[model samples]
Target: MSFHFEYPRTIAARRPGEFKPAAPKFHVRWQAPVTTIVSDYIAVQRQASDMAAERAFFQRMRRAFDSAYGPDSFEEMRQTDEAGMVNSIVVAYWTDIVRYALWKHVDSFNAWFRSTEREQEAVGYWRETLTVPYDRMETIFSEPYYHAGLARTRQAALEPMYTAGYFGAMRDRLPISAIDPLNSPYGETTPEGNYAGGPVRRVRVDVPPNVVSIRSGQVWQKAEGEQLDDYYQNLQPKLETGMAYLKEHPETTGYLSLRAIVHLDKDGQELRETSKHGYFLALAQLERWAAEHKSHLDIFKHALAMRRKYGADRQVVTWHEVFVLGTTPSLEYINCHPGTGLLRFANVWGNPPPSN
Candidate 1:
């Protein structure tokens, strides 16, 4: 199904947060020196003996990336070969934080990991890491979808809601301690509803336009036998539960709209020189026939609200640096229907991109 959004205001905060740093998904595969089970086990055992050293090295590495590339630096997209012998690929969202860090450090990282010292210490845990930046990776698109739809008639006059009531109401959801007009990016304003609160949860607004895009990151630290066993044991059940929930509520059901993002570009002058990825075509509409389905819409809103509250801390496996700042209160906007014709606006890149 196809959807459209229109707004009189050119600047309005979004649900969950005004702006989220782009975190492209990733898939990494490296060539291991020992593919055989005995050799691989022996290598892992050696690495296991020195897991602390690797972790400490990565901690320092992460700090450097944060200092030089910013928090969203490692939000690269990753994929593993579902088929045999395919090269593993990493598809990262191209942000300055990511670009600079990868451009500067990836080669160095490869050199270090493959050095005789590291390989001898931690076998089988890593091969050589390869990276491929993607405009929009497929893993995210393959997941179930959730979002709001909004449309306003053309006659709606554009205005700036940068400091309007909507923002104030959803102030709690802002990422920063508070909205500092002098320093913060406009997109990082209060309206975005922290990292989790959306229009329904934070402020009074129409249902947001469908979620056309998303980016995310994950990290797996090297661990030894006992540590790995304990960690995975604790993690697997949660992952299983979450997967079960998604399986039960697949995108094909409910008020869901799925889009294939075709293009992505960084915030820049002239705008044209920035990155361009792909176009989106709606693949399914769970709410297509139910234009007036408030119940189904509420279901999605409820799920998101819960996710914002619990997913990040307990269920989700995510990179460590990024955090949810605040959330918008769950509130709804009531539209006084006009004489049939309604105002509409198009999808736009909200605020300026986060400065790395």
Candidate 2:
């Protein structure tokens, strides 16, 4: 079924001609290497008491980005939950990965992370960074004007290619048959020549008739050898069940779409990572899903229990940030790619090119 969004109209009305129609065409885009995505999870223990400081901290971060890379170099979005958790994500496209690496070591950049105030505050801070080469990535824009995610870099118009069904969209990107088990570009290889990397997982479920929702995330083990082996063996089954449940009951969940990807290192490795990253289309759905589903709760309780058992020093730190739709200037939309997150609901918020 076709999903409809109410805000695009409101957004358009507010901005007047900003959302006006553009040319009707399909396109393929490539992000220059080494493209990087940085996500920061900032949580205040006392929400009411620390709200002001949290906001100020975020503002300071914005200023830092502006001063270091110019306003247009990056895009940022913030999401806050009822439980007082806050997640801010910044996505920047770099023409050169070496430059991006150098900037991180700059005095001011290093100082921001080392700030004594941040360290002493009750707030917790964690960051994940991922850098990927251009050829290792793929992007599709359903219309000529829409641009978001990796599409933020370069785009070229292409002929329209429709999918046969829900899975077809994913197949268009990388056919299941062509997916290289040994040397997938999606992740890095281990010393043993095994693909021991974290790659984004995409799930698609039918909304009925003419629409579908796509959800994507990353899966990785926190520790090496036995610990990592046990983590995936246990987590994979639960993830499958969760995806099935979500597709089976979408209405009660408000689960339009979701994406949870862990940022990888510059070499595309995620070995023994301490933190993870994710973005949700709707925070309410996540809350509802977690509260109502035992599996979801089990995952949470298990993680907490494991941490307690192992102690903080040995346990993995997990955190996520949610983005407010359209708030990120860098998240510009030109068109909707079929069966992609949020893009599936483009019927509501998307601006389709003018019909010939």
Candidate 3:
């Protein structure tokens, strides 16, 4: 790997001769290592036919989350998955897992989640959370700009990345990958959903080994005038198109599930911010898609163009957190439309590259 300067790290362990990335990039450095970080994605959804009810449920939950975690930052987003369901999501992050535990038990929030009324409503509810140790997560940044996503540390720093922007780079960036091949399991990949048109069927998913999940965030809130127009008119639309492809062709791309989300306000209304949280069977599959897919390549080119134009003054921030989850990632959906997120490959999905 090649770097123009040196900086502290908030990335995974590095490897040997065959391990070091020949093409170097940049990443972030947190204040200190977080032993465990918990990310919770709370989603409230309903069918396209029940738009009014769904928005109501979304606002109610948003109010509940705001009251439960007053000072902490909770990012809100909207998702339309492949199930023909409209979902409103609130993403909460806890650097210390213990704090998350306290928040989870908040009386009002818990009551809402456990209430019998939820079974009666047309709206569906789901939360897909994953708690991972420090070593399992890998992060990278193109420039020393914004600390988007989980990199929102108290005072984050930026460092050079030796292993990124190329094929097999994610595996090289992961410290655990040095020892564990981080491959996916091969087994029965059938789903287990009670799709009998019930309003209260809750299914808990068992995450297969080495399943790679990523939260790629892009915030154009700081852009203005021409930059703003470019982002909304060209950049963001491109991102949405790519996300749709990933959602539609999961088997071809090794993407089990994907969500293109827009930010929400206190009133649960959508804003300019956006992000994509995706899941793949293995790190290698994700890398292949990023490095080989034309869809991703277009996104990559547009990013470079914007970065070059603005240089350090760029208001647009792009970042992503890549985590190879340990088994038992918490993925649950209640009354959700069928085939919602990781549900498609319920019985231990494996990481086999799509047929060429």
Number of the top candidate by lDDT? Answer: 3
TM-score of 1: 0.24
For every model shown, the clashing-pair count is 40, 8, 1
Model 2 lDDT per residue over 1-356, tens place:
21111111211111223332232223333322233332222222234445565456556655655544322244444334323444333445444544555555652744665454544555544332333332222333323343334434433223333321121222223221133221212122111111111221211121121111221322243455654665667654565566556645656544444333233333323333222223233334544576668767666566545545554333233322222222211121111123333334334433334333
Number of the candidate with higher TM-score, 1 or 3: 3
lDDT for 58 in candidate 2 is 52
TM-score for each model: 0.24, 0.39, 0.78
List all candidate RMSDs to the true structure. 22.5, 21.4, 6.9
Off by over 4 Å in 1: 1-51, 63-107, 127-239, 244-356
Candidate 1: 10-residue stretch with minimal lDDT: 34-43
The alpha-carbon lDDT assigned to residue 269 of candidate 1 equals 11
Q: Candidate 3: list runs displaced more than 4 Å.
A: 1-28, 47-72, 106-108, 143-145, 153-163, 187-200, 232-234, 346-356
Query: How displaced is residue 271 in candidate 1, in Å?
Result: 38
Q: For model 1, how does the per-residue alpha-carbon lDDT over 171-289 read when each residue is reduced to its tens digit?
A: 22222213322121222121222222222211122222222121222222333464345335644344334323322443332211111111111211111011111111111222221
Point to the candidate with the largest TM-score: 3
